[model samples]
Every structure is written in C-alpha cells, then in structure tokens.
Target: MAWHKKPKTNLTKLRIVRMIVQIIMFFLLNLVFFEIGANWLVLPINMPQTIFSSSEGSFFLLQRMLSRAIIPLIPLASFLIIGGIFGRLFCAWGCPFGLFQDIIGLITSWVKKYEPTHSTNNSMRQIGELITGGTLLISTFIGISVGLGNQADVEAAFGSFFEQPWAVLSPAVFLFTAIPVIVYWGVLGELFRIENLGSIDILLWIRLAIFIGAIIMIIYIPRGWCRWICPVGIIMGRLGEHSLIGVGRNITKCNHCGICEDVCPMGVQILSHPAERVRSVHCTNCLDCIPACDEDAMELKIL
Candidate 1:
C-alpha cells in the first residue's frame, strides 16, 4: 500500500504536455456542455456516452450494438484502426477516466503509490483480459438470445447486465452516465422509499461500491484500474500490442537507473523491454518515462 523507497524524479515536460492533452480530450469527448446530439464517432478511449451524448468509446458501443443484434461494423473498425495507430495511447491521453487518475496520481505523488514488480504486474493483467472477453461473450450471448426471441428469458437472467456486463458496474460509466441520469431523474426519491427498503435495487448500491472501490485503489496504487481491470484497455492491448507508436529506450545513453520504471504509473519495466521499443500490452504510450530519465535514455519510437 505504500512505496517505502524509490528514486526521486522531477515533474517532467512530457508529463505536463500529457496532462494538457488529457484536459483537451476530456472536454472534447464529453461534449456535455455543448450537447452536440447523438453521433457515431467511436474511438478507443474510456469515455461513457448516454443516449443524448455525442461520443462513446468503442468498447461500450460494441456491447450495445451486439446486444441489439447489430454487427457493429463501425465500432469494430474504430477499435482496430485506432488501436493499430495509437495502441493504448487513447487510454493515456484521451480517456476522461485517465485524466481523473492523472489528477489523483499528481496529488499522491508526494507519498508515492506502491509499485509492483514487473512479474507480478504482468500476472495481474490477465484479469483485464478475462473481463474484456467475458463481457464480450455475455454481449454475444444476449445477442443470440434476443435473435432467438428469448427476450423474457434474457431479462430474467441478466436484468441490467444484459446489454453491458462489466459496464453495469463500470466505474467510469457510473461516474459519467449513471450518476447524472440518477440526479436528473430524481432517483434519490426512490432510494429510500422512506417506508420500504425492499423496493431498492441492490445493484445501485453495488454499482456505487464498485465506483468507489476503483477510486480507492488508484489512491494507493497508480493506474490500478487501468493495469488490473479495464476491459477497454485489454481490448486495445490485444489489438495494438505491437503498435507502431510507442515508448523506446535509448540503450546507448541508458545507465539502468530505474527512474523511468519508478515514474511509470503502469509499472512497465523499461530496462527489460527491448531497446528499440516497449511492446508490453500494459504500456499505454503515456511517455511519462521520457523526462524521468536524466541520462536522456527514453524517447518515443515510430515504426
């Protein structure tokens, strides 16, 4: 829960630049202030869009389309094309949730979050893959069920979980969509029922618990949700693990000081990765390691 020892690193230029990009993307994707109307500009980011919203990440769109028995051609294409070009770059620079985590990381940087060894970190990433695939499978199953006219059975079994599995409990989704919808619809009046507690949906409390749990995890471990549980991250990682755009280590100028790894919220082992590029799926192309290196050992690589 605590990083007892680590190398000190100054706030780097790349980090600041990334924060700027995160800020810009945050507003652009939300469009809540503008209300541009519904559109299909899907991308590989961790954004949540409601029916009235203008944007959505490919992962959610994929589940939604599949649940309706649609092929989701555009969303599928968005994930591949964007992930190919940027890898998890959207996760780092464009995701609103990523921006939120960056703010938390900045605040907690003084105390420092615990950094797991690369091996342990890598093992934990399997959890994300399972979540990503599991959600997709559920979506596909529901699609098939709906196609077979088993609507009642589907609702009986899934309820809120029908369209989006993990997303029903997704922290970003709850933060961005569920919360707003609740407040706007005056759902608070239903929660207490003042007379009867049985009318309350247990899922509501469970969703809030998950949302809070994710935030709590990030406070003690940087990018904990990204590294361990984001279904969108795993999907992008699979589609873009060998992406052309990524971080590279300049071995010639490198001294293996470990500052880059220490600064990396994802706990990427920069020293062990290939000098030409880091191909780890866990890497979000954050470029945080760049300025952390005093030896000028880190740089961006374009294939």
Candidate 2:
C-alpha cells in the first residue's frame, strides 16, 4: 500500500527573474529620449519600432533594408548568429512585445488559456510562414524596382508601403511609436476638441485595429502573435530548431506526466524532443517547463 506524490511547480522565482530581464531589455531597446547610436547593431529580436526606438531588431531592419534595395547582410547575419547560439532565447528574455504579451497573459490568468490540438496548432503556425514569405516577396519586388530605376513608378503605386509595407501594418509600431506620437503631439486632444473623427489617418485606424486584435489574441491564447502571426518568429523558430543551447530531460526523474507541454507558451511538444535536448523550434528558452515539472526532469543544457 504505497502512494506516489507529484512535485509542485515553483513559478515564483523564475517569473521574477524573467520579468526583471524583460523590463531591463525594454528600456535598453527603447531609450526614446536619447540618441545612443546603436542602430547599426541589430539584434535577432522582434522589438519592432522605428521613430522612437533606437535599437533595431533584425527582422525590422531586414524589411527596411530589402525594401530600399539594400542586401541586409548585417540583419541576416545577426539572425543566423544569435539564433544559432541562443535559440530564440531573446524572445523570452528581451523582446518588449513578448513582455507585453506576458503581461496580458498574467492579467487574464483567471481565464483558461486556449489549448489547440497538435495538428491544429501546427496548421495555425503556417500563418506566420505565409506572412514571412509574402512580406519578403513584397520587399524583394520593391528592391528590384528600386535597383532597376523604377522607384518613382513603384512609389506612385505603393506610396509609403513601398518604403516599408509590413511596418505600416505592424502592431508593435502602434504600441511603441503611434501611441506615443499621438500623446506627444496632442493629436488626440486636438481631435477631441474638434470631434473630427474623419480626420483620423486610415493607417492609424488599421494599426489600432491590428493592435487590439493582437492584445485580444494574447489574452486568449498566450503568445498568440508569437506563435501564429509574427514573420520574425518563423525565421527564429527555424534556426532554433537545431540550436546549441536548449532544455534537456533527466530520464531518471521523468515519469512522462506531460506537464511541461502544458505551460509552454509556444505550444512545443517537449517530450517529443531527444532526451538530452528539447530542441523544438518554437522553444524561446523561457524555461517555464523546468519549474512546471514536479519530477525535476528538465535541465538547461548547452553544447
């Protein structure tokens, strides 16, 4: 007559550490008040801002560079190097967008997070792939046009979208630049004074719509944009699939309870990875699974 007892997950310490890191990185990535001259040093993150943000995330720069007929060597290199070494860990530790989503998840903790089946989830991830491919194609088209001296024609057609199509629709731009610009310029107050709703920019309304949709997605599905929408995430996930640093399992302690997958924001099937390396492409190295495993089965392994 013996009974087995499961260990409880200790989310407190890891959450505190992650929150501190996210906050510090947000400020460093921002620094809107100062011209730090760090734009040249693009990191493989999806921070995504232009005017106010001094730091450039690799994907943002990629879109901009390609659209301008520039070969984005630096941004591509940053993605390869960082994604190779850290396996998208920056998303967990540094991305401001990730911080926002995590905060939303926290606020809506009382609501049960939506959990899609594996096949369904995999299909949903294709949305990001399509977006990445489509964005790159559009940028490539603009680049070729610019390189061929047809910039005027292209600009006449696409206008601002010819410069940076994705950023025009980016939710992060709304969060980081649009909102601040609105406040700083007193545009909202002026609009309210006149009550001129039609005067609002169409792009602003579109961005606001997208931003609200993103917030709602994260609240319901937790990291929904990261999982199913972000073009940058698709690239990072592909690189991170075979990354050096990752979580591994201690088979001796593991009872295969499947708790690790429950808490994963990216919906990775943790147990499916090799015992010594849980190298799932979607893993941001959040390490939330490590604490969730009551059996103490998971460990951060680096090679």
Give lDDT per model, in order.
0.81, 0.82
lDDT of 2 at 164: 69
The global Cα lDDT (0 to 1) of model 1 is 0.81
Lowest-lDDT window of 10 residues in candidate 1?
1-10
Indicate which candidate wins on TM-score: 2
Cα error, residue 65 of model 2, in Å, equals 1.1
Poorest lDDT segment (10 consecutive residues) of candidate 2: 1-10
Error of 1 at 90 (Å): 0.7
Stretches > 4 Å off in candidate 2: 1-9, 32-35, 38-40, 192-194
lDDT of 2: 0.82
| Candidate 2 local Cα displacement, residue 249, angstroms | 0.9
For 1-303, candidate 2 gives per-residue lDDT tens digits of 011123243766787889999998887776765766455558877666556576888888898899889999999999999989888898899888889889998889889788777676778989889988988899999999999999899889988688768878888767777777888888777864656768777877777889999998888888888888887778998899878888999999999988788767788898888888887767899998898887889999987
TM-scores for all candidates: the values are 0.89, 0.92
